[model samples]
Target: MNHFPLFADLKGRRVLVVGAGPVADRKIALLLAAGARVVVGARAAHPRVLARAHAGEIDLRLGEFNPAWLDDAWLAIAATDDRALNRKVSEAAAARRLFCNVVDDPELSSVQVPAIVDRSPVTIAISSGGSAPVIARRLRERIESLFDHSLGALADLARRRRPAIRAARPGLRARRAFYDWLLDGPVLGALRRGRPDEAERLLDEALAQAAAPPRGRVLLVGAGPGDPGLLTLRGLRALNEADVILHDRLVDAGVLSLARRDALLIDVGKAPGGRHEATQARIHALMVSHARQGRCVVRLKGGDPLVFGRGGEELQHLRRHGIDYEVVPGITAALACGAYAGIPLTHRDHAQSLTLATAHRRGGACADAEPESGRTRAYYMGVERLAGLRAQLLAGGLAPDTPCAIVENGSRSGQRALYATLENVENQARRHAIRSPALIIVGEVAALGRELAWFGEILDGEPATAATARLAAA
Candidate 1:
């Protein structure tokens, strides 16, 4: 964010380069390609510069660096090895109020060149503010592989049909919908297969059908457990396409940042002591209302929506209303919490089975089930009921010394894991001042966390107030 990215109109503009070496040669080539009238001033001109000058491709002046060379220039570049000469060029450009780039010296340059992926009319530029040029180039190379040479042809096709498409679909929304169809339909496929005629035909057919109203749909997306990286590609697509997003409070800001900037976001998460039924009713109403308006609606839920996330109710409601919908699954908390805490849910030697449950219902009633032997149990939102849950397990003939771990803010920067026995889990959590949005793991595998821990190195029987441990965990 240190620099605002912009595409300057340098076509038919005057540009000055203060060197004729390899560095200056590269800059001049780029300037010429951009349609800039480049002038190279150097005491000794490079062979390529002389050739270009002879061919009348560029203006070459054989002389030492001079402030007069910057006259009538829209942009200036100092690429000579002499630091003093580069500094002089920069100062002259500044006095003339012209933007200048000093080769390999970002501190003196007004603008730094970016690594670009060129698809002619479509260009993607990436810059690390001149701090990491190699990294920027690496990123550009990765992006280059995802796109093919056919993209230039695709852009050309779009440019040619824009006027006709706009005239056929007067509404902006309808026009955008037609383009989306064109890109996702057989037109793009035909282009990729090197059949331009077929692509144009498909485009014509789509344009003919643009008068029809666009269909509305719903996408049920899982935001995953705290980490944005865990979000699926399909989920990201749904977010970008959504006209409105209904998100839960537990969905992190990082995940929400991926959605369309102009998309309306509605928080449907139930607050403490809030009526669950009424909130659910409101969510249902919002989904139906938005979809009926021919808009794309996204119901974003934390973790896998189907796993105790009440996604079934929403799906049933959508089905009853005959709304088109798709579900994109996400990594649930059980997996994220266990991995981040360095505790596996199932181990061949320790746990052969796993059980996921909640300690309390939505109404705050104790829904604790007896802890089955030889099975790993993960309890969601159970930190507040640790005491009651522990008592219930003990009453059910569970061992008092059963290993347990409480993972707070799992997969997040503030994550903490406290390992203790079932008998003292409540005390350990209280001593460490544990909070909600935590998962409790109980099984023999929980004891393995002390040794198998990789993410954070907090050991069992150790005090949780160690600053180094928290920093490492973060």
Candidate 2:
């Protein structure tokens, strides 16, 4: 590193700022936050600086730059636009052996402020050696995304219990392992889930028996609708920290690739016309077994787990097994597909409410759940049963001309939206060879997709006359 990076302790120390413009005001604010005594020497000052002076937060001296300003300062900052004045400040600080930062003039600055991501007790700083500040800022943004805000709490808790932790794990290696467990295991997870008491209990439990086998837990995380970008931050963190992952087959490969490199991946997906009950039993067994072995188990499923994804059943199974678990919600297919296909499930003019159902329920049971007038209906697994759905809707006295849409692959890059009327929906499915993993939407709002659709291909399955009329209206 060309410049040594260190966090200075300036608490109650005098720091001199040469110039009181906006830039100086910003530096002074940082100085004040760091508990530094600030003395400003400038030809003029920003109104905020004057206000701070009046408030006695900073001592403002309005006059020409003076070398005497650096006499007692622990650090100096030159933020003036004038190059000569900045150089003078830099040279004076150099003569006094005081570190100085000349704003926007890296060559003259002995200290360069780095972009900071402050999770309080857990702060991260990024610098490009004063050569690429923008790059440093971008790096800071990525770090901010990767770390949870609860990290500060986790850090503080560790600090408070450091003596206990040290006593529990006397060896250096043992202490390091304990710290790793604190970071990757249930303690941090508990904090992230907003159970600080539980987190404290878990930490205490660990400290009580530091040599015992680590406790295991399960995180049921939603992978979202086929798009990795839709995955939640908590879900990503779980995947990265997982020791074992029991994932559905439909979970995106891109999502799987984000897991810990050494994590064991087990496919527990069930298929139609397959032994689903047995498969579900096996999944439950795997989750319980891995977690019992002190592994961080992730039951990764596509879309929101509770929304017809059997998440509730899995949670029930986990509870029955006495396994510690947390649920991370994902963007459900109904919402993701509706947004991607530009079909608002509920619109003021077209639809007042939305009904979600599955097509495979016996005896046309889902038909009873059909949306009323001025409402929209979405079927999760109906692409294969479109003809039966159409017939059921007709038998239920629904309008033959009701707009329908089939959203395939939802938010994926290859997603497609096929539009048709209730009467012709079956025909359109047959013509387009529509497949499973598609959502079916029915209502007047489905018709608005043709006009509002922005992402993916839109296929019109309406009759030529109707299509011509709609196009003319547009």
Candidate 3:
């Protein structure tokens, strides 16, 4: 470490700022937020600084560079355009044994300010030892997105209950376990939902039952359709807290990478036409076994678990065994595929309603649900059943020329959107060799994809016409 990082307590302490520019104003604001008694010694004060001085918020001494200003200061900051003056302030502070920071001159300063992500009581500081401040700031930005405003409230709750928690569970291990429950259980959920009273009650209830062994729980998380960025915040939290993750084969590797590094990952994915019932039974057994051991189990499924992911069956199995569980919804393929393909599922001018269905059903039978006219229809896992789907929709009264789009590998790299009408959709699929993990969109709005297709335009791959050549041939 080039510099030893330490958070100073500036509450009621005098800090001197030797400039009146925007940079000095920023440092003064941070100091004031930390309750510092700011003393500004500058040739001329910035408008904001002058305003604060007039309001008696800070002490302002308008003058030339003076070493006398460092007399009673605990810390000093020199943020000026003049290099000589900034170095003079740094030398004066060094003589007085005070830590000073020179803006844009790291070598001349005794201290450097770090990039901060403030969740109040849970503030995170990132420092690059003044060697790479931009990199430090970028790192902080990435970390800041993972945490929300509720983290500070959660910290406050913990602080207020520390005394009671210590009294209830005096043993360090037991107390730590209690805190884990507080953070990973319903108390944190209540806090996230903006229910502080409920959070408090939940915490109290858990503390009252701290003597008992912690119960295991399961969270059914939707990993979204291939893209990790589409995963919900709550789903990400569940993955991070999981002791064991039962993930599907289709769940993107990017999504799995976000889980706790040490988490036990079990592939519970059932291959198409491969002993489906046996695979499902094994999934149920694994969830029950791990959860019974008081482990935090995550059932990570691709897309919205409830929509064709057999999430309902798993939920029923958990309920039958009396296991505690919660569900986190993900972006299903129909929604993600439609947006990425630029085919709005519902448009007032083209489609007033939307219908989601599956073309491929159990036992190789076409799903009996018929697509109605006027509403946009999206079919999941329909790549193989394109001909059957087209026939069924036509029989159900959709026009032969109704526009359609086949979105393959939706929301992922190498994603392709093939545009065609109902009459030639099956031909287009066969010509382009469209595969599974693709969605079938049928409606007047599907035609709009040709004009509004944005993702394809930006991506550096095959042109949209390459996939839609069959339509052009027709």
Candidate 4:
């Protein structure tokens, strides 16, 4: 509520980034990507920034931070960790009403940066104010796994043909319906296989047969979190036929690899570096354009599209537009991450109610900004926000003694888990040096993990054994 949710058009804009370290480098990277004329005020910069400067991509000012650095700047970022310096930079920006970030200090920031997942032509952002950056980042990562680089090509196809499609279909609803079909079907499959020719051919055929273009339909494709092996048959089928894949950052890379080679793989993923409505709009447009062109369109997403994937908004859009789209369910991160990490999402005695909560607000504000209420909780982006999450859960009718389990890199090699009671989980995670791209499950069932876990048995540094004993126990 404190900040407006809007994309700042950085193309041809001036952005001053104060700092040359990782955080400074991070902001500068995004500015440059938005086609801004970026200038950096720092004593020294990372090699990547230096390379950009040498290549004439940025203007770098060496040695220290100064208020004059804000002169004539359209936007600024106080990437320095020095709170004092960040505050000064922030004050300068506020005087001019120019946007600025104080890195981890949102209180001093005029703008807070969110995690971004970019596949050109399509981008997604996830924020959590400054309360839990790690959780926001993990959520972003989950979104990223749903799409690939092919989305650029998908966007290009639609852009090239938008005028004709609109002209042919006078009704916005009808036109949107047509686009919906093309995206989820042939167009997607064709592109995924690196066959643009096939995409065009199938599109023409479908259009020739339809009154307008093809009808749009909703698909419920499941992207099993982190483990490509966990994807279902229908999910794989849907992925191959996608025209516009709208995904989050936490999806598995291996799952994305299954998409057709030339498919219009979109990264409608919200994470750390990329955030914008342009990408979201582009996704809808791509679906509409392709469906109108009589190309099969797929709105591929991470997990079940209905679960925090915002499939509902899309369905509404499709309905209003009179597009025929179907919902293809995906494996929600909680289910996949928990199962693969040796923890069931729910159990009879452990959890009477299961809740999925976003660790962030709509504009990337932390849960502290507006803490969610839940019991028997499983958090999608709670790694960085563990402390906040723990506090919130404790306050929200959940006992402080509730058992919690942290799953990192679930469903794939390198998966690790940390189990503890609610009161000690935050400290446990800190003590164990846990990081982002992890999920937190809190409840009694989480305690059952030690007893019911088989994934850990496989990873327990012991060969798979005791089949007879396991059967007897079961």
Candidate 5:
């Protein structure tokens, strides 16, 4: 973010390069290709520079560096070996209010040239603000490999057919969909197969055909915990294709950023002290309304939507309205927290089964809840009701010494796991000031967090008051 990325229109402009080395030669070649009027200034000119000058391809001055060389120059590049000389050029360009690049010198340069992947009319630039050029170059190579060379031809076709595309699909949403089809469908395939005529004919026929109106559909996408990397590929695709995204508050900003730039983002997460049911109703309404408008709506929830995420409720509502929808499941908190905390939920020596439970119910905590023998019970959203849950477990003949672990911000960089026992879980949670969005695991496997913890901090058994853990919920 340190450098603002831009695609400057250097065509028909003048540029000055104050070096004759290979580095300068490379920069000069790129500038010339960009249609810049190149002027080379160096005490000793390279053979290539001399040849370009002799061929009237460039205006070359063989002499000491001069400030006058930057006159009428739209941009300047100082690629010389002398740091002082490059600094001088940078200062001179700064005085003229012209952007300049000091090769390999971030402090002296006003702008850093980025590594590029050029699919002409669709150029992608990667930069580390001149801090890590090698990394940028590596990224460029990866991007280059992912895109086909014929992509430029596809872009050219799109450019030529834009007018017809607009006329055929006047609606903005429909137009965008059509453009997506052009990229993903047979048009790009035809061009990639080196059949330009076939590609053009396909485009013409697609535009000539009576296009169906865009249909609205809902996609339930699971955003796993707080890590963007944990998102499923199907979830990522749903996000990119969404016209409207209604996401939970727990959904990370990094996850939301993966969606289309123009997609409308709405936070539909219920907040503390808010009417939960009403909030859910509003979310349902929003989804239905947007889908009815023929827009692709995405209900993005953290963790598996069906696993205590109320995804089933949303699906039922969609079905009542006969709306089209798809589900992309995500890694639930129980699984994520256990793995991240290095506590296997179903260790053969500890637990025989796994129970996914909610701490609070509509009627309140299930007072008569029974703990199954040798089962690992993962309590969702249970941080605030730990005391009540502890009492219920104890009343139901659960062992007082049964091990427990509270995982906060699971799967995230700031994750913390607090290990305690059923008898002391409430006390330990109170001492730690555990917050919501935390998951509670009650079983012998929970004790493994202390010895097996890997991803985050672990708060083990301690008697000191100052050693309080801060376990916050999502």
Candidate 6:
């Protein structure tokens, strides 16, 4: 941020170059591309430079360094092999107050050329002044990998259709949201295949259907637990189509970034163990209001909505209001936490059955929760109610010696884990500093960590082993 950003107007401006070597040749190319009329002031030219002069692309002068070269020039470059000559060019340009770049010499130059990524109409330039051109070039190479050339064409198409979209949506927010949908949806494919026309046609069709701007439809989208990548394609489609996203506290930011930029993001999240009625009511209104006005609304929820994610309740509300809606299933907490953490929900030697139960609240106390019969049980949000969960499981005849594991921040970078028997699960989890966004498993199959742990080994850079606590902290 040391230097302010500026764009120079080069069209038809004169550029004077004091060398015809590779360095000067590069400067000449950039100037010519910017449409600057270039004059090479060197006595002899490289074959390429001589060719360019003969082809009338540049005006070549046969002479030693001369101060008169700066007379009518907007910019000048001193790229000669002789440092004395380069210094002379610098002093001449400075006296005349003209911008000058002395090749590879920062102290004598007014400006330094930068490494550039040009997808014309979408150019990215990286510069370290003249201090580190190598670093600048490396960064440019990295940036060049992030965006494809098709983006320029895609942007052009959108620009070309601005008038039509304005006529169709009228509202600024609506128009912006429509473009967001296009960028996140099939338009990218069209642009990649060199089908801008088809992409434009499809977009026009979608906009035309917006005769009323596709009314808000409630989509119960599962933002697969905490791992953003686990979200389903259908869920991604819902997010892209949404005009608003009503999310909970548990939904990851990485997942939310996939939402339309202009979409209204409403955080209806509740505290752990807090009431959800008000949140649900507010979500209901946003969905209904936008839908009534013909907006695509997305009710973004973490984990599989049907599996204790209260997705059914939202669906029920949408149904009662007669709102168009559908559910996009996300990777459930039970499967995601256990799988990514290297815990097998069902193992051949120890677990013959799998079960999932909420540990947060059950009718009043965890004691009131139903006992799931299985070799393994994944308790969601159950840390605070662990004692109660243990009692309920013991009461249901589960063995106290059963292996149990806790996985926190499953599949996220800071994931932690703890492994212990059912009798010591809560205690071990506490000692190991297990926190929320965690899943607890109790059953013989949990002991299968003696084998099936892949993610844990990858994380610690160790070979797979029975003692890796694979599922607990993976």
The segments of candidate 6 whose C-alpha lies over 4 angstroms from its true place after superposition are 1-46, 53-161, 172-213, 365-374, 448-474
- Alpha-carbon TM-score of each model against the true structure: 0.90, 0.60, 0.62, 0.48, 0.93, 0.68
Off by over 4 Å in 3: 1-177, 180-209, 368-371, 395-397, 457-474
- Give candidate 1's whole-model lDDT: 0.86
Candidate 3 clash total? 0
All candidates: CA RMSD in angstroms?
4.1, 9.8, 8.3, 17.5, 4.0, 6.9
Against the reference, the lDDT scores of all candidates come to: 0.86, 0.88, 0.86, 0.71, 0.88, 0.77
lDDT of 3 by residue, 137-206 (tens): 9999999998877889999999999999999988654675787787678887898898999999988887
RMSD over all Cα atoms, model 6: 6.9
lDDT of 6 by residue, 1-474 (tens): 554545678899898999998778988999899899999999678999999999999999988878887779988899899998899999999999998888888999887777888876566788888888889989998999988778787777877888888898888557767877777788878989988778878887798775444455778888887877788988988887787788988899999998888888989888865667777777777778878877777888888878877777778878898999988888888887788767778766556787677876646555333444455778888877777788777787766665677777877767665666766666666676667878887765565544565554222212234335543542
Per TM-score, the best of the predicted structures is 5
Query: For model 6, where is the 10-residue window of minimal lDDT?
Result: 457-466
Cα misplacement distance, residue 266 of candidate 1 (Å) = 2.4
Question: Which stretches of candidate 2 lie above 4 Å from their native place?
Answer: 1-213, 362-364, 369-371, 463-474
What is the TM-score of candidate 4? Answer: 0.48
Deviation in Å, model 5, residue 199 alpha carbon: 0.6
**TM-score of predicted model 6?**
0.68
Tens-digit lDDT string for candidate 1 (1-474): 799898888899999999998889999999998999999999888898889999998999987788999889999999999999899999999999999999788888998889899887888899988888899999999999998777877889999998988889987558767777776777878888999999999888877763878677889999999889989898998898999999998899999999999899999998766898899999999999999998899999999989878899999999999999999999999999899888889877668899898887756665445666568989988887889888888887778877889888888877888888888888878888888788899887787676566664353544434323532432
Which candidate, 1 or 3, would have the higher TM-score against the true structure? 1
Per-residue lDDT for 1-474 in model 2, tens only?
A: 588889988999999999999999999998998899999999999999999999999999999998998878999999999999999999999999999999888999999988899887777889887889899999998889989899999999999999999888876546766898998899999999999999999999888873855678999999999999899999998997788999998899989999988889999888878998899989989989988887789999989888888889999998998999999999999999999999989987768888888887655565554437888988888877777788888788788888889999999888889988898988888898877789999888888788788999888898657844643553
TM for candidate 1 is 0.90
| Pairs in clash, predicted candidate 6 | 43-63, 210-213, 214-294, 215-294, 215-295, 216-291, 216-295, 416-473, 417-472, 417-473
Q: Look at candidate 6 and tell me the lDDT of residue 457.
A: 26
Model 1 Cα RMSD, 1 decimal: 4.1
